[model samples]
Target: MINANKTLSLAIMSGKGGVGKTNLSLNLSYALNTGGNSLLLMDCDLGLANLDVLLGISPESNMQDLLTSGAKPSDIVIPIEQGKKFDILPAASGVPELVEMDEDMQDLLFSKITELVGGYQYLVLDLGAGINGTVLSFAAMTQMRIVVITPEPTSLTDSYALIKVLHSQHNVSDFNIVVNQATNEKEARETFNRLNMACEKFLNIKLKNMGYVRYDPAVTEAVRRQIPFIKYAPKSEASRDILNIAVKIQKIRMENMGRLSERPVMKKFPTLDD
Candidate 1:
Protein backbone atom coordinates (compact mmCIF):
# COMPACT_ATOMS: atom_id res chain seq x y z
CA MET A 1 0.00 0.00 0.00
CA ILE A 2 1.16 3.53 -0.74
CA ASN A 3 1.85 5.90 2.09
CA ALA A 4 -0.60 8.71 2.55
CA ASN A 5 1.38 11.88 1.93
CA LYS A 6 2.07 14.62 -0.53
CA THR A 7 2.18 13.10 -3.99
CA LEU A 8 4.63 14.41 -6.56
CA SER A 9 2.46 15.61 -9.43
CA LEU A 10 3.90 15.68 -12.95
CA ALA A 11 2.30 16.92 -16.14
CA ILE A 12 3.57 15.45 -19.39
CA MET A 13 2.71 17.89 -22.16
CA SER A 14 3.73 18.63 -25.73
CA GLY A 15 3.51 21.66 -27.99
CA LYS A 16 1.68 19.77 -30.73
CA GLY A 17 -0.09 16.50 -31.22
CA GLY A 18 1.59 13.25 -32.44
CA VAL A 19 4.85 13.99 -30.64
CA GLY A 20 4.45 10.77 -28.62
CA LYS A 21 3.54 12.59 -25.40
CA THR A 22 0.85 10.12 -24.37
CA ASN A 23 2.95 7.10 -25.26
CA LEU A 24 5.85 8.50 -23.25
CA SER A 25 3.53 9.26 -20.35
CA LEU A 26 2.23 5.69 -20.27
CA ASN A 27 5.64 4.11 -20.52
CA LEU A 28 7.07 6.49 -17.92
CA SER A 29 4.30 5.54 -15.53
CA TYR A 30 5.10 1.86 -16.04
CA ALA A 31 8.80 2.53 -15.45
CA LEU A 32 8.03 4.37 -12.22
CA ASN A 33 5.79 1.53 -11.11
CA THR A 34 8.43 -1.05 -11.89
CA GLY A 35 10.63 0.88 -9.45
CA GLY A 36 8.09 -0.04 -6.70
CA ASN A 37 6.29 3.27 -6.43
CA SER A 38 2.50 3.42 -6.79
CA LEU A 39 1.23 5.98 -9.27
CA LEU A 40 -1.97 7.34 -10.82
CA LEU A 41 -1.95 8.28 -14.51
CA MET A 42 -4.75 10.70 -15.37
CA ASP A 43 -5.76 11.08 -19.01
CA CYS A 44 -6.20 14.84 -19.09
CA ASP A 45 -6.80 14.94 -22.84
CA LEU A 46 -10.46 15.53 -21.98
CA GLY A 47 -12.03 15.46 -25.40
CA LEU A 48 -10.16 12.56 -26.96
CA ALA A 49 -9.40 10.26 -24.05
CA ASN A 50 -7.61 7.12 -25.23
CA LEU A 51 -5.21 5.99 -22.49
CA ASP A 52 -7.63 3.18 -21.95
CA VAL A 53 -7.57 2.41 -25.63
CA LEU A 54 -3.80 2.08 -25.44
CA LEU A 55 -4.10 -0.35 -22.54
CA GLY A 56 -6.90 -2.32 -24.25
CA ILE A 57 -9.27 -1.78 -21.31
CA SER A 58 -12.74 -0.30 -21.24
CA PRO A 59 -13.53 1.99 -18.32
CA GLU A 60 -17.10 1.99 -17.08
CA SER A 61 -16.61 5.35 -15.36
CA ASN A 62 -14.78 8.47 -16.42
CA MET A 63 -14.11 12.07 -15.38
CA GLN A 64 -17.54 13.10 -16.63
CA ASP A 65 -19.17 10.59 -14.32
CA LEU A 66 -17.21 11.98 -11.41
CA LEU A 67 -18.34 15.51 -12.25
CA THR A 68 -21.99 14.78 -12.98
CA SER A 69 -22.71 11.92 -10.58
CA GLY A 70 -20.62 13.04 -7.60
CA ALA A 71 -18.80 9.74 -7.74
CA LYS A 72 -16.01 9.00 -5.30
CA PRO A 73 -12.63 9.41 -6.92
CA SER A 74 -11.77 5.83 -6.04
CA ASP A 75 -14.92 4.67 -7.78
CA ILE A 76 -13.78 6.13 -11.07
CA VAL A 77 -10.16 4.94 -10.86
CA ILE A 78 -9.26 1.77 -12.76
CA PRO A 79 -6.34 -0.47 -11.87
CA ILE A 80 -3.96 -1.89 -14.45
CA GLU A 81 -1.28 -4.57 -14.39
CA GLN A 82 -3.51 -6.68 -12.16
CA GLY A 83 -4.04 -3.87 -9.63
CA LYS A 84 -0.55 -4.10 -8.30
CA LYS A 85 0.95 -1.02 -9.93
CA PHE A 86 -0.62 1.89 -11.77
CA ASP A 87 -4.17 3.26 -11.46
CA ILE A 88 -5.76 5.40 -14.15
CA LEU A 89 -8.41 8.09 -14.15
CA PRO A 90 -9.90 7.78 -17.61
CA ALA A 91 -11.58 10.67 -19.42
CA ALA A 92 -14.57 10.71 -21.76
CA SER A 93 -13.62 11.08 -25.41
CA GLY A 94 -15.43 13.37 -27.86
CA VAL A 95 -16.84 15.60 -25.12
CA PRO A 96 -15.90 18.99 -26.46
CA GLU A 97 -17.03 20.96 -23.41
CA LEU A 98 -14.70 19.09 -21.12
CA VAL A 99 -11.79 20.54 -23.01
CA GLU A 100 -12.54 23.98 -21.59
CA MET A 101 -13.43 23.48 -17.97
CA ASP A 102 -13.67 26.77 -16.09
CA GLU A 103 -11.27 27.75 -13.34
CA ASP A 104 -13.57 26.89 -10.45
CA MET A 105 -14.38 23.51 -11.92
CA GLN A 106 -10.72 22.79 -12.56
CA ASP A 107 -9.89 23.74 -9.00
CA LEU A 108 -12.68 21.57 -7.63
CA LEU A 109 -11.55 18.65 -9.75
CA PHE A 110 -7.96 19.03 -8.57
CA SER A 111 -9.00 19.23 -4.94
CA LYS A 112 -10.69 15.90 -5.36
CA ILE A 113 -7.66 14.68 -7.22
CA THR A 114 -5.39 15.76 -4.41
CA GLU A 115 -7.45 13.72 -2.01
CA LEU A 116 -7.69 10.70 -4.27
CA VAL A 117 -4.01 10.56 -5.11
CA GLY A 118 -2.68 11.49 -1.70
CA GLY A 119 -1.79 7.91 -0.89
CA TYR A 120 0.26 7.38 -4.01
CA GLN A 121 3.80 8.61 -4.51
CA TYR A 122 3.17 10.21 -7.88
CA LEU A 123 0.33 11.42 -10.10
CA VAL A 124 1.17 11.65 -13.77
CA LEU A 125 -1.12 13.87 -15.82
CA ASP A 126 -1.08 13.27 -19.58
CA LEU A 127 -2.15 16.66 -20.85
CA GLY A 128 -3.27 17.51 -24.36
CA ALA A 129 -0.85 19.07 -26.78
CA GLY A 130 -0.76 22.84 -27.50
CA ILE A 131 -1.12 25.88 -25.32
CA ASN A 132 -4.63 26.44 -24.05
CA GLY A 133 -6.19 27.62 -20.81
CA THR A 134 -6.81 24.06 -19.62
CA VAL A 135 -3.35 22.85 -20.49
CA LEU A 136 -1.65 25.88 -18.97
CA SER A 137 -3.66 25.64 -15.77
CA PHE A 138 -2.89 21.96 -15.20
CA ALA A 139 0.77 22.34 -16.12
CA ALA A 140 1.16 25.25 -13.73
CA MET A 141 -0.25 23.24 -10.84
CA THR A 142 2.17 20.38 -11.12
CA GLN A 143 5.58 20.36 -9.42
CA MET A 144 7.27 19.15 -12.59
CA ARG A 145 6.34 20.03 -16.16
CA ILE A 146 7.84 17.86 -18.89
CA VAL A 147 7.63 19.22 -22.44
CA VAL A 148 7.94 16.65 -25.22
CA ILE A 149 9.33 17.61 -28.58
CA THR A 150 10.81 16.12 -31.74
CA PRO A 151 13.41 17.09 -34.34
CA GLU A 152 10.88 18.46 -36.81
CA PRO A 153 10.91 22.20 -37.39
CA THR A 154 7.22 22.48 -36.58
CA SER A 155 7.67 20.59 -33.34
CA LEU A 156 10.58 22.80 -32.33
CA THR A 157 8.71 26.00 -33.15
CA ASP A 158 5.59 25.00 -31.28
CA SER A 159 7.57 23.78 -28.27
CA TYR A 160 9.39 27.10 -27.96
CA ALA A 161 6.04 28.86 -28.31
CA LEU A 162 4.65 26.70 -25.50
CA ILE A 163 7.59 27.50 -23.22
CA LYS A 164 7.23 31.22 -23.94
CA VAL A 165 3.52 31.17 -23.24
CA LEU A 166 3.92 29.27 -19.99
CA HIS A 167 6.74 31.52 -18.88
CA SER A 168 5.16 34.83 -19.79
CA GLN A 169 1.64 33.95 -18.75
CA HIS A 170 2.05 31.60 -15.81
CA ASN A 171 5.54 32.51 -14.60
CA VAL A 172 6.64 28.91 -15.14
CA SER A 173 10.41 29.00 -15.47
CA ASP A 174 11.68 25.53 -14.76
CA PHE A 175 10.93 23.10 -17.55
CA ASN A 176 12.25 19.65 -18.43
CA ILE A 177 12.60 18.74 -22.08
CA VAL A 178 12.35 15.28 -23.59
CA VAL A 179 13.35 14.64 -27.19
CA ASN A 180 11.23 11.91 -28.66
CA GLN A 181 11.66 9.84 -31.82
CA ALA A 182 15.19 10.99 -32.51
CA THR A 183 17.24 9.03 -35.00
CA ASN A 184 20.36 9.16 -32.82
CA GLU A 185 21.91 10.90 -29.83
CA LYS A 186 23.57 13.43 -32.11
CA GLU A 187 20.20 14.30 -33.58
CA ALA A 188 18.69 14.49 -30.09
CA ARG A 189 21.46 16.77 -28.76
CA GLU A 190 21.20 18.96 -31.81
CA THR A 191 17.46 19.31 -31.26
CA PHE A 192 17.88 20.12 -27.56
CA ASN A 193 20.73 22.54 -28.20
CA ARG A 194 18.72 24.44 -30.77
CA LEU A 195 15.75 24.73 -28.41
CA ASN A 196 17.99 25.51 -25.45
CA MET A 197 19.76 28.31 -27.31
CA ALA A 198 16.45 29.79 -28.40
CA CYS A 199 14.98 29.72 -24.90
CA GLU A 200 18.11 31.23 -23.41
CA LYS A 201 18.39 33.95 -26.04
CA PHE A 202 14.72 34.90 -26.18
CA LEU A 203 12.79 33.69 -23.14
CA ASN A 204 15.81 33.72 -20.75
CA ILE A 205 14.71 30.38 -19.40
CA LYS A 206 17.02 27.43 -18.74
CA LEU A 207 15.59 24.21 -20.14
CA LYS A 208 17.01 20.94 -18.85
CA ASN A 209 17.43 18.08 -21.22
CA MET A 210 15.88 15.26 -19.19
CA GLY A 211 16.82 12.70 -21.86
CA TYR A 212 15.97 11.49 -25.35
CA VAL A 213 14.26 8.42 -26.76
CA ARG A 214 15.48 6.88 -29.99
CA TYR A 215 12.97 6.20 -32.74
CA ASP A 216 12.15 2.53 -32.66
CA PRO A 217 9.80 0.33 -34.70
CA ALA A 218 8.92 -1.55 -31.52
CA VAL A 219 7.04 1.50 -30.30
CA THR A 220 4.59 1.20 -33.18
CA GLU A 221 4.36 -2.53 -32.64
CA ALA A 222 3.58 -1.98 -28.97
CA VAL A 223 0.86 0.47 -29.89
CA ARG A 224 -0.60 -2.03 -32.31
CA ARG A 225 -0.47 -4.68 -29.60
CA GLN A 226 -2.18 -2.30 -27.13
CA ILE A 227 0.59 -2.67 -24.59
CA PRO A 228 3.09 -0.09 -23.37
CA PHE A 229 6.42 -0.27 -25.17
CA ILE A 230 8.16 -0.63 -21.80
CA LYS A 231 6.23 -3.85 -21.27
CA TYR A 232 5.83 -5.01 -24.84
CA ALA A 233 9.47 -4.61 -25.75
CA PRO A 234 11.37 -4.21 -22.53
CA LYS A 235 14.62 -4.80 -24.36
CA SER A 236 13.94 -2.15 -27.01
CA GLU A 237 16.13 0.94 -27.14
CA ALA A 238 13.13 3.22 -26.61
CA SER A 239 12.17 1.31 -23.47
CA ARG A 240 15.69 1.65 -22.10
CA ASP A 241 15.65 5.34 -22.83
CA ILE A 242 12.35 5.77 -20.97
CA LEU A 243 13.71 3.82 -18.02
CA ASN A 244 16.74 6.12 -17.86
CA ILE A 245 14.45 9.14 -17.89
CA ALA A 246 12.39 7.62 -15.11
CA VAL A 247 15.51 7.17 -13.01
CA LYS A 248 16.42 10.80 -13.50
CA ILE A 249 12.92 11.76 -12.41
CA GLN A 250 13.27 9.70 -9.25
CA LYS A 251 16.60 11.31 -8.52
CA ILE A 252 15.09 14.74 -9.02
CA ARG A 253 12.31 13.93 -6.59
CA MET A 254 14.76 12.79 -3.97
CA GLU A 255 16.83 15.93 -4.33
CA ASN A 256 13.69 18.05 -4.08
CA MET A 257 12.67 16.20 -0.94
CA GLY A 258 16.01 17.00 0.62
CA ARG A 259 15.57 20.65 -0.26
CA LEU A 260 12.06 20.61 1.19
CA SER A 261 13.40 19.53 4.55
CA GLU A 262 15.38 22.74 4.68
CA ARG A 263 12.54 24.95 3.50
CA PRO A 264 9.71 23.17 5.33
CA VAL A 265 7.04 24.96 3.39
CA MET A 266 5.21 24.18 0.17
CA LYS A 267 4.56 26.63 -2.60
CA LYS A 268 0.95 27.62 -3.03
CA PHE A 269 -0.83 25.78 -5.80
CA PRO A 270 -1.15 28.22 -8.68
CA THR A 271 -4.72 29.23 -9.39
CA LEU A 272 -5.85 28.70 -12.95
CA ASP A 273 -6.10 32.38 -13.65
CA ASP A 274 -2.82 33.17 -11.95
Candidate 2:
Protein backbone atom coordinates (compact mmCIF):
# COMPACT_ATOMS: atom_id res chain seq x y z
CA MET A 1 0.00 0.00 0.00
CA ILE A 2 1.40 3.40 -0.98
CA ASN A 3 1.13 6.39 1.37
CA ALA A 4 -0.65 4.43 4.07
CA ASN A 5 -0.77 6.29 7.42
CA LYS A 6 -2.47 3.93 9.81
CA THR A 7 0.47 3.76 12.25
CA LEU A 8 1.00 6.11 15.20
CA SER A 9 4.61 7.01 14.36
CA LEU A 10 6.54 8.04 17.49
CA ALA A 11 10.24 8.89 17.55
CA ILE A 12 12.03 8.26 20.87
CA MET A 13 14.99 10.56 20.30
CA SER A 14 17.51 12.53 22.39
CA GLY A 15 19.80 15.58 22.18
CA LYS A 16 22.90 13.53 22.97
CA GLY A 17 24.10 10.00 23.52
CA GLY A 18 24.55 8.19 26.88
CA VAL A 19 21.11 9.36 28.02
CA GLY A 20 19.56 5.85 27.82
CA LYS A 21 17.58 6.74 24.70
CA THR A 22 17.98 3.29 23.13
CA ASN A 23 17.12 1.49 26.36
CA LEU A 24 14.03 3.65 26.79
CA SER A 25 13.02 2.93 23.22
CA LEU A 26 13.25 -0.81 23.82
CA ASN A 27 11.31 -0.81 27.09
CA LEU A 28 8.79 1.68 25.74
CA SER A 29 8.22 -0.56 22.76
CA TYR A 30 7.59 -3.55 25.02
CA ALA A 31 5.29 -1.54 27.28
CA LEU A 32 3.21 -0.20 24.39
CA ASN A 33 3.08 -3.37 22.35
CA THR A 34 0.36 -4.89 24.41
CA GLY A 35 -3.43 -5.45 24.16
CA GLY A 36 -3.16 -6.57 20.53
CA ASN A 37 -1.11 -3.54 19.49
CA SER A 38 1.34 -4.29 16.70
CA LEU A 39 4.48 -2.16 16.86
CA LEU A 40 7.71 -1.54 14.94
CA LEU A 41 10.82 -0.27 16.74
CA MET A 42 13.37 1.10 14.29
CA ASP A 43 16.96 1.94 15.07
CA CYS A 44 17.37 5.13 13.04
CA ASP A 45 20.85 5.66 14.47
CA LEU A 46 22.53 4.30 11.37
CA GLY A 47 25.84 5.91 12.36
CA LEU A 48 26.12 4.37 15.82
CA ALA A 49 23.53 1.61 15.69
CA ASN A 50 23.12 -0.42 18.92
CA LEU A 51 19.46 -1.47 19.20
CA ASP A 52 20.43 -4.86 17.84
CA VAL A 53 23.06 -5.23 20.56
CA LEU A 54 20.60 -4.04 23.19
CA LEU A 55 18.07 -6.68 22.15
CA GLY A 56 20.75 -9.34 21.58
CA ILE A 57 19.20 -10.22 18.24
CA SER A 58 20.99 -10.45 14.92
CA PRO A 59 18.85 -9.63 11.94
CA GLU A 60 19.59 -11.00 8.49
CA SER A 61 19.11 -7.59 6.91
CA ASN A 62 19.55 -4.06 8.21
CA MET A 63 19.48 -0.48 6.89
CA GLN A 64 22.78 -1.19 5.16
CA ASP A 65 20.98 -3.69 2.94
CA LEU A 66 18.17 -1.21 2.45
CA LEU A 67 20.50 1.60 1.30
CA THR A 68 23.05 -0.47 -0.60
CA SER A 69 21.04 -3.28 -2.17
CA GLY A 70 17.69 -1.48 -2.30
CA ALA A 71 16.15 -3.92 0.15
CA LYS A 72 12.49 -3.33 0.95
CA PRO A 73 11.45 -2.39 4.49
CA SER A 74 9.42 -5.57 4.71
CA ASP A 75 12.53 -7.49 3.81
CA ILE A 76 14.68 -5.95 6.52
CA VAL A 77 12.19 -5.79 9.39
CA ILE A 78 12.47 -8.59 12.01
CA PRO A 79 10.59 -9.42 15.18
CA ILE A 80 12.09 -7.46 18.10
CA GLU A 81 12.00 -10.73 19.96
CA GLN A 82 11.45 -13.98 18.10
CA GLY A 83 8.06 -15.51 18.93
CA LYS A 84 6.98 -12.10 20.20
CA LYS A 85 4.35 -9.64 18.98
CA PHE A 86 6.48 -6.54 18.23
CA ASP A 87 9.03 -5.92 15.44
CA ILE A 88 12.19 -3.87 14.83
CA LEU A 89 14.13 -2.66 11.81
CA PRO A 90 17.80 -2.98 12.72
CA ALA A 91 20.26 -0.14 12.07
CA ALA A 92 22.65 0.01 9.15
CA SER A 93 26.00 -1.76 9.42
CA GLY A 94 28.17 1.14 8.28
CA VAL A 95 27.94 4.80 9.28
CA PRO A 96 26.20 6.11 6.19
CA GLU A 97 25.95 9.86 6.71
CA LEU A 98 22.59 11.27 5.56
CA VAL A 99 24.08 14.59 4.33
CA GLU A 100 26.70 12.67 2.42
CA MET A 101 24.14 10.22 1.06
CA ASP A 102 22.10 11.16 -2.02
CA GLU A 103 18.79 12.88 -1.32
CA ASP A 104 16.93 10.66 -3.77
CA MET A 105 18.13 7.55 -1.96
CA GLN A 106 17.12 9.01 1.38
CA ASP A 107 13.68 9.83 0.02
CA LEU A 108 13.27 6.35 -1.39
CA LEU A 109 14.33 4.68 1.84
CA PHE A 110 11.92 6.61 4.05
CA SER A 111 9.21 6.47 1.45
CA LYS A 112 9.52 2.72 1.39
CA ILE A 113 9.44 2.60 5.19
CA THR A 114 6.40 4.87 5.35
CA GLU A 115 4.65 2.63 2.89
CA LEU A 116 5.69 -0.55 4.65
CA VAL A 117 4.85 0.47 8.24
CA GLY A 118 1.18 1.16 7.50
CA GLY A 119 0.32 -2.41 8.37
CA TYR A 120 1.26 -1.89 12.02
CA GLN A 121 -0.41 0.12 14.78
CA TYR A 122 2.71 1.96 15.96
CA LEU A 123 6.17 2.90 14.61
CA VAL A 124 8.75 3.71 17.29
CA LEU A 125 11.99 5.17 15.96
CA ASP A 126 15.14 5.27 18.14
CA LEU A 127 16.85 8.09 16.29
CA GLY A 128 20.46 9.14 16.63
CA ALA A 129 21.57 11.94 18.95
CA GLY A 130 22.38 15.50 17.85
CA ILE A 131 20.85 17.76 15.19
CA ASN A 132 21.59 16.66 11.67
CA GLY A 133 19.70 16.78 8.38
CA THR A 134 19.04 13.04 8.51
CA VAL A 135 17.81 13.04 12.09
CA LEU A 136 15.75 16.20 11.56
CA SER A 137 14.16 14.86 8.41
CA PHE A 138 13.07 11.66 10.16
CA ALA A 139 11.94 13.61 13.21
CA ALA A 140 9.77 15.87 11.07
CA MET A 141 7.74 12.96 9.69
CA THR A 142 6.68 11.30 12.92
CA GLN A 143 3.29 11.94 14.55
CA MET A 144 4.95 12.31 17.98
CA ARG A 145 8.53 13.33 18.83
CA ILE A 146 9.78 12.50 22.36
CA VAL A 147 13.08 14.16 23.28
CA VAL A 148 14.68 12.04 26.01
CA ILE A 149 16.97 14.01 28.31
CA THR A 150 18.64 13.64 31.72
CA PRO A 151 19.30 15.68 34.89
CA GLU A 152 22.73 16.77 33.66
CA PRO A 153 23.47 20.34 32.57
CA THR A 154 25.08 19.12 29.35
CA SER A 155 22.08 16.97 28.51
CA LEU A 156 19.75 19.94 29.05
CA THR A 157 21.90 22.25 26.92
CA ASP A 158 22.30 19.80 24.07
CA SER A 159 18.60 18.93 24.09
CA TYR A 160 17.78 22.62 23.93
CA ALA A 161 20.11 22.97 20.98
CA LEU A 162 18.26 20.12 19.27
CA ILE A 163 14.90 21.68 20.08
CA LYS A 164 16.13 25.01 18.73
CA VAL A 165 17.26 23.53 15.41
CA LEU A 166 14.03 21.61 14.88
CA HIS A 167 11.94 24.65 15.78
CA SER A 168 13.90 27.18 13.75
CA GLN A 169 14.84 25.05 10.77
CA HIS A 170 11.84 22.73 10.44
CA ASN A 171 9.03 24.79 11.94
CA VAL A 172 8.43 22.02 14.47
CA SER A 173 6.27 23.62 17.12
CA ASP A 174 5.61 20.77 19.56
CA PHE A 175 7.97 18.39 21.39
CA ASN A 176 7.49 15.76 24.12
CA ILE A 177 10.18 15.64 26.82
CA VAL A 178 11.21 12.59 28.87
CA VAL A 179 13.82 13.04 31.59
CA ASN A 180 15.72 9.77 31.87
CA GLN A 181 18.00 8.78 34.77
CA ALA A 182 16.20 11.10 37.16
CA THR A 183 16.62 10.49 40.87
CA ASN A 184 13.08 11.55 41.74
CA GLU A 185 9.92 13.06 40.31
CA LYS A 186 10.90 16.51 41.55
CA GLU A 187 14.26 16.34 39.86
CA ALA A 188 12.67 15.16 36.60
CA ARG A 189 10.11 17.94 36.69
CA GLU A 190 12.79 20.50 37.45
CA THR A 191 14.93 19.22 34.59
CA PHE A 192 11.97 19.40 32.23
CA ASN A 193 11.06 22.87 33.45
CA ARG A 194 14.58 24.15 32.80
CA LEU A 195 14.41 22.90 29.22
CA ASN A 196 10.83 24.08 28.77
CA MET A 197 11.66 27.47 30.24
CA ALA A 198 14.42 27.93 27.69
CA CYS A 199 12.08 26.94 24.85
CA GLU A 200 9.25 29.17 26.02
CA LYS A 201 11.50 32.14 26.61
CA PHE A 202 13.62 31.84 23.48
CA LEU A 203 11.75 29.75 20.88
CA ASN A 204 8.13 30.32 21.99
CA ILE A 205 7.61 26.58 22.19
CA LYS A 206 5.72 24.88 25.00
CA LEU A 207 7.01 21.37 25.62
CA LYS A 208 5.00 18.41 26.88
CA ASN A 209 6.13 16.48 29.91
CA MET A 210 5.86 12.79 29.01
CA GLY A 211 7.36 11.74 32.37
CA TYR A 212 10.74 10.30 33.45
CA VAL A 213 12.59 7.09 34.29
CA ARG A 214 14.20 6.87 37.70
CA TYR A 215 17.80 5.78 37.95
CA ASP A 216 17.76 2.07 38.76
CA PRO A 217 20.47 -0.56 39.02
CA ALA A 218 18.08 -2.95 37.28
CA VAL A 219 18.59 -0.87 34.15
CA THR A 220 22.34 -1.56 34.19
CA GLU A 221 21.76 -5.25 34.78
CA ALA A 222 19.19 -5.39 31.99
CA VAL A 223 21.70 -3.80 29.62
CA ARG A 224 24.30 -6.34 30.61
CA ARG A 225 21.81 -9.13 29.91
CA GLN A 226 20.76 -7.46 26.65
CA ILE A 227 17.11 -7.39 27.70
CA PRO A 228 14.50 -4.66 28.05
CA PHE A 229 14.44 -3.56 31.68
CA ILE A 230 10.69 -3.61 31.79
CA LYS A 231 10.81 -7.35 31.04
CA TYR A 232 13.86 -7.99 33.14
CA ALA A 233 12.62 -6.11 36.20
CA PRO A 234 8.91 -5.47 35.86
CA LYS A 235 8.63 -4.03 39.38
CA SER A 236 11.68 -1.78 39.19
CA GLU A 237 11.30 1.98 39.60
CA ALA A 238 12.46 2.69 36.06
CA SER A 239 10.03 0.14 34.65
CA ARG A 240 7.16 1.69 36.57
CA ASP A 241 8.04 5.13 35.22
CA ILE A 242 8.25 3.82 31.64
CA LEU A 243 4.91 2.03 32.04
CA ASN A 244 3.35 5.29 33.17
CA ILE A 245 4.80 7.00 30.14
CA ALA A 246 3.27 4.22 28.06
CA VAL A 247 -0.13 5.20 29.43
CA LYS A 248 0.32 8.76 28.21
CA ILE A 249 1.49 7.39 24.89
CA GLN A 250 -1.66 5.25 24.59
CA LYS A 251 -3.86 8.28 25.23
CA ILE A 252 -2.09 10.14 22.46
CA ARG A 253 -2.34 7.08 20.24
CA MET A 254 -6.12 7.24 20.36
CA GLU A 255 -6.07 10.94 19.47
CA ASN A 256 -3.66 10.28 16.60
CA MET A 257 -5.81 7.45 15.22
CA GLY A 258 -8.83 9.73 15.35
CA ARG A 259 -6.96 12.38 13.39
CA LEU A 260 -5.95 9.82 10.78
CA SER A 261 -9.52 8.62 10.39
CA GLU A 262 -10.68 12.11 9.39
CA ARG A 263 -8.47 12.16 6.31
CA PRO A 264 -9.95 10.77 3.09
CA VAL A 265 -6.72 8.93 2.33
CA MET A 266 -3.90 8.78 4.83
CA LYS A 267 -0.69 10.25 3.45
CA LYS A 268 2.41 8.12 2.99
CA PHE A 269 4.33 10.19 5.57
CA PRO A 270 2.62 11.93 8.50
CA THR A 271 3.83 14.99 10.43
CA LEU A 272 2.79 16.92 13.54
CA ASP A 273 -0.71 18.18 12.72
CA ASP A 274 -1.13 18.88 16.44
Candidate 1's C-alpha runs over 4 A off are 1-5, 258-274
Q: Model 1, range 85-150, lDDT digits (tens) per residue?
A: 679999999998889989877867876666677667778999999998889888887778899999
Alpha carbon lDDT of residue 251, candidate 1?
Answer: 85
For each candidate, what TM-score against the reference? Answer: 0.93, 0.92
Number of the top-ranking candidate, with TM-score as the measure: 1
Q: Candidate 2 — what's its lDDT?
A: 0.82
| lDDT of each residue in 1-274, candidate 2, tens digit only | 3333557878878889899999999899999885468888888887778898988877887887887787888888887656555888888656656434555766777767766677778778898898877788778767778999999999999999999998888778889999999999999999999999999999999999999999999999999999889889999999899999999988887867767554312232455464
Candidate 1 achieves a global lDDT of 0.86
Model 2 CA lDDT for position 247: 90
True-vs-predicted CA distance for residue 240, candidate 2, Å:
0.8
Q: What is the alpha-carbon RMSD of candidate 2 to the true structure?
A: 2.3
